[model samples]
Target: MVIPVLAIVFTLYFFSTILNSPWTAQVSAFSLGSLLLLFCVIFVAKTVYQLRRGDGTLSFGNIVSRDDLASGRVGLFLATLGFTLLIDYLGFTLTTFLFLLVSMTILARGRGFMRITLVSALMALGGWAVFILAFDTRFPRGWFETTMKAVLANG
Candidate 1:
């Protein structure tokens, strides 16, 4: 319920901002926003009908709770924030590897660290190779990437 409301508001603001852009530049945003708004309207109507029928009630405690934040979710959120902020400095592959390793360690409760690290490293390297090498997608080159290139060149 709260998610849909936020999505509707976000879509409206996004549309407003993109309105001045050229058609080609705004087409994807316009299309996606239109669909989002349409679904939101339908959801709103259904939710209102359910409330009038006493079938559903909004509970702020359930929707946005301090307990959720207290239960290590805040740490996960902070971890994600850190990942996003440090990505340009760490580069995609290394950042993703560290993020996955940390998140798994946090959530896995007594899981073996070395096993998790190995798995994370394999997945991260595979993803980086696929996207950066095979597909030729461009990701930010930070200190790690630069050093790897230098080592490879020197070898």
Candidate 2:
């Protein structure tokens, strides 16, 4: 319930910030934020309904139990945090690739190393192509983007 409420608030705040942005930026932000806000509203409403009917109890214990820590939740959280912190320094594509690789590795319990690496690389490249190349988003430029820009310019 708290998480959903926070999500709603964040989505609204994000929408407010994007008002003066370009149409492409506004469209993408609104599309994703609206869905987040809608889902959060629905979840909060359902939780309230369940509470009123005495069908469910709010338990914060399950949110951070030992099983959750053992199940790679902590690793995923750290990976997400790292992604946010490192994105500016490393740029979007490279940071995204590293984050995905680490996240997939954690989720797979260290299995499928080769496949995870390949998928991560492909996804990072695809994101670069779409967001950086097609949309020309303001993602920070690093080695990969710089090199690609040079190659494309020369070619």
Segments in model 2 whose C-alpha atoms lie over 4 Å from true places: 1-60
Candidate 1, pairs of clashing residues: none
On residues 4-91, what C-alpha lDDT tens digit does candidate 2 reach at each position?
Answer: 8788888889988889989988988899898898888889889999999999998777678887778999999999999999988888
Q: Deviation in angstroms for 127 in model 2?
A: 0.5
Supply the global lDDT for candidate 1.
Answer: 0.83
Task: Compose the digit string of candidate 1's lDDT tens values, residues 1-155.
Answer: 88899999899898888788999879999888899999999999999999999999978887558976656576677779989998988998899898888877776653799999999899988987787757857787666667766787799
- Candidate no. 1 TM-score: 0.61
Candidate 1 C-alpha error for residue 32, in Å: 11
RMSD to native, candidate 1: 5.0
